[model samples]
Target: MIEILDPAQLPRARAVGALVATILQTAKARCQVGTNLLDIDAWTRSMIEDAGAESCYVDYAPSFGRGPFGHYICTSVNDAVLHGLPHDYAVVDGDLVTLDLAVSLDGVVADSAVSFVVGQGRPEDTAMITATREALAAGIAAARPGARVGDLSHAIGTVLRAAGYPVNTEFGGHGVGSTMHQDPHVPNDGRPGRGFKLRPGLLLALEPWVMADTATLVTDADGWTLRSATGARTAHSEHTVAITRDGAEVLTLPPAA
Candidate 1:
């Protein structure tokens, strides 16, 4: 369902967004060569409880995934890109990690994701991560009252394609508000001047993800994690944005220290 949040709910949205961003940043900071994926999940759980927020992923059960995600955060390493269910795995140096988080606070929900390398990053991986981040920015920049969903998608695609990465539309961004996923599926690539028209009070989670060499994806044995078909490294970047009278306001930015 498409939900246009009221001004009264905007503050709740911002609060949840801040929580998600803060948790992601904290998880990223603790990622080390010997860090365990389970530990990250535990840390996320604690933070969510301490903040009096609800994890959108812990009980998530979608058609594409196995029932009940049973994890607090999505820990994607290397080729693993989307829906990365946390498992028993130790992070190694130079491992590319993507942390996707969503939470509900005061009845509002926010979602965001970030991709980064653990230790010394590889040139290609760094470039791919930069490309997703740039695409996400482009998408947000295109978001404003009266803008069409295609406009945002096109802007995101232009950046990813230019960076020589294949775009995958199977899993992309979506509208977010009281729930984690809502209407207006925002693909990573699309033709401009099409799809849903942006309006004030609308909230969209614009994510731009890409596989280094191929667009195809293969599910892992766990039936949750999605990895590059060619075993190529991947990256994803996302943020929850609110359509405002002036422009798009990013709700999921990390809180300033």
Candidate 2:
């Protein structure tokens, strides 16, 4: 369902956005070489509980995924990209990790994701992460009151293609408001003038992700983690944005250090 949040609801939306951002940032900070993936999930749970926010992931049963995600956060490592279920694994130096999170506070929801190297960074991995981040920025910049969803998708696709990465259309951004995922599916690539028109109070989670080599994906035995078909490394970046008269307001920016 598409939800145009009321002005009064925007504040609650912002609060939930802030909470999700802070939790992701905190998880990123705690991630290091030898850190267990389960630990990261635990940390996320504690933070959300402390803030009195509900996890939009845990217990989440969507048709695309196995029922009940049963985790507080998504910890994608190396070849893993989306729906990465936390498991018994420890991060190592040079590992590229993506953390995706969504939470509800005061009855509003926000979602965001970030990809970064765990310890000593690999140049190629760093470049991939940068590309996704740039693409996400481009997508958000295209999210204006009069712009179409395709404009945002085109902007994102342009950045990724310019960076020499193949775009995947299966999973992309989507409308977000009272629910984690809603109508107006925002693909990573599309015609600029086509698709749903943007309006004030529309909230969208724009994500851009790419694999180092192939665009194809393979599901892990766990039935949740999605990895590159060729075991190529991947990176993902995302943000929850609100369309307004002025432009897009990014609600999931990490808190200032």
Candidate 2 lDDT by residue in tens digits, 38-79: 999999999999999899988899887776999999999999
Candidate 1's TM-score reads: 0.99
My TM-score estimates for the predictions, one after another, are 0.99, 0.99
Candidate 2 segments whose C-alpha is farther than 4 A from its true place: none
- Give the Cα lDDT of each candidate: 0.93, 0.92
lDDT of 1 by residue, 1-257 (tens): 99998888888888888899999999989989999999999999999999999999988999998768889899999999998988889999899999999999998899999999998888999899999999999999999999999999999999999999888888899999888999999999999999999999999999999888999999988889999999999999999999999999999998788
True-structure Cα RMSD, model 2 = 0.7
Clashing pairs in 1: none
lDDT of 1: 0.93
120 Cα displacement, candidate 2 (Å): 1.1
